[model samples]
Target: MKCVKTQDAVGHVLCHDITQIIKDVKKGTAFRKGHIVTEEDIPVLLSLGKDNLYIWEKTEGILHENEAAEYLRDICMNENMIQSEVKEGKIELIAEIDGLLKIDVDKLRAVNSLGEMMIATRHTNTTVKKGDKLVGTRIIPLLIEQEKMEKAKEVAGDRPILSLIPFKKKKVGIVTTGNEVFYGRIKDTFGPVVAEKVKEFGADVIGQTIVNDDIEKITKAVEEFIEQGADMVLCTGGMSVDPDDKTPGAIKNTGARIVSYGAPVLPGAMMLLAYYEKDGRELPIVGLPGCVMYAKRTVFDLVLPRLMADDMVTSDDLAGLGLGGLCLSCDICTFPNCGFGKGV
Candidate 1:
């Protein structure tokens, strides 16, 4: 790029976007890249504080900022995502579907480590809606060596750094386990809470059973739900250390592979996660602790979106959630938007 005085810039192509800002009024590009400067535009350019303007000069082995931004976008965007028009040497990637956002963090970091370029993304592995901004990419300078962007692309590999996995409609079975509720001593609040949460993901509660804190009964209920075409099973209550709590044992008795029996998260430490496989089909079973009924968000909220997207949860995944597991319990709950379990 070459710099030329605004008064003498007539007929020269702009190398970068010229921005204009009026306090509390507006802020935007006054002259876009490739705009040929003319006599009438000289006054407007001077008003924006541009005494000199950058004019495009093709240099071998170098690329303009706008071209560098497009290269970054090409490396980051994946399925169900769209890119915004380049502005001021920056591009934003937006979600094209309501789904879970997944970012390949290692690759992202590798690409960002390349000098003079950047790719910033929203929190990964979280639910997002169509049109939500997922990522932004830009070149720090007006011109960059073409080799730098090529190295970034190599670091990013063939797979795009960002992806949106659409949620699958699921048939869910709920098993509420507590003797007091089963015996009619108290209302079954746990069942309703679990049902509502499942509905939020657009999954249906095909059936629910109120069972006493009996390991045998809980096991039977899970099996029955799977037989009835339920793809997922939720067992609420009876997951604590108390002698009456037997939900975890019941899940194990169903022959499911227990992914985890406890989590590091507050309000959900006693939760259990398991997966059952039979006849080439797999089902996820969760033993929710009592805190799920009172806490606005818990481990369940952290893991549910992945399950809905058919992403398997493992013991290592749960272990990695400890760093951001404690909820602040703010006056106004903004769960999923808050950092309750995004440690990894």
Candidate 2:
């Protein structure tokens, strides 16, 4: 143990040294200085820590770092903390995973783990058994001084668990109310748009109603739809400051508790949510502002998931929309899957 020369002789049996290295705690400096570095070196390197490891198996496949990070992250960090791939060597991760890592656009050749969003996704329509290897992750190696990883781990608790979404079918009801529609002055375009949106959740429009702007009549129709067992209701138009817009008054008069009479989101800020319950069953009735009819997206985007899940919608729940409540429309209307109020 005293001289480097003595250790080099012991290093001749390299395989034995590797196994013993796991037990030794001395840093790499201790072994590197010795000529016969025994099994003492391996554990130090292993302990030094790495965000990802670029592993190449014997058969030959270009193992990407971020891809490896996805696979390795679940193993290293789970249920807490976060990890991402930062630009190091030369690789821009695949488009979908660009969120998981930060990269130096100039270098697609080296390797690093700077910005990685500790998440990955896989889609399977064919059924998967439990414990299937859904993603692959790896560790990145730079000339890192192993001790730093402790600080990093402290900063990141357990790694985040992959978020999985479960989609389901829903039964919806459409109540289109307006004097213009009832009088045939305007075609009923709102009904079709709302119906199509509900279908995106694999939901069926179980009921549809067209009523003149009479608060009493609209209220009665809502009650009837609930009696007919509609899980969700959408009341289009009649949502603004106009005195004649009676959808809100109608839903409330039907013994339904109003959730939010107006939301803060644009193009649909005037939207309202109502809930009806009698005999231990709950039904959600939403009043769609005119903006939802043509603006492509709005506050309706915020509550649709809960509607599809048959979750209870309360005034308090609607109050929470003030935060992160705006929806931006793009040239593309790729909806139900975009960042527009995914409750980020």
Residue-level lDDT of model 1, residues 1-344, one tens digit each, is 78989999998779778899999999998888867789999999999899999897778998878778899999988999988998667999999999999889999889888879999998888899998999988889877899988999889999998889999999999999888999999998888898898898899999889999889999999999999989999998888888889888889999999998999998799889999996896789999988899888888899899999988888988998899989888999987777888775
TM-scores, one per candidate: 0.90, 0.56
Instruction: Summarize candidate 2's per-residue lDDT along 42-138 as a digit string, tens digits.
Output: 3543454411222222223333333333333433332212344432211221222111111122121111133332323332111122333333333
Best by lDDT: 1
Against the reference, the lDDT scores of all candidates come to 0.89, 0.54
> Residue 144 of model 1: what lDDT?
87
Query: Candidate 1 vs. truth: CA RMSD?
Result: 3.3
Candidate 2's C-alpha runs over 4 A off are 1-165, 313-317, 332-339, 342-344
TM-score of 2: 0.56
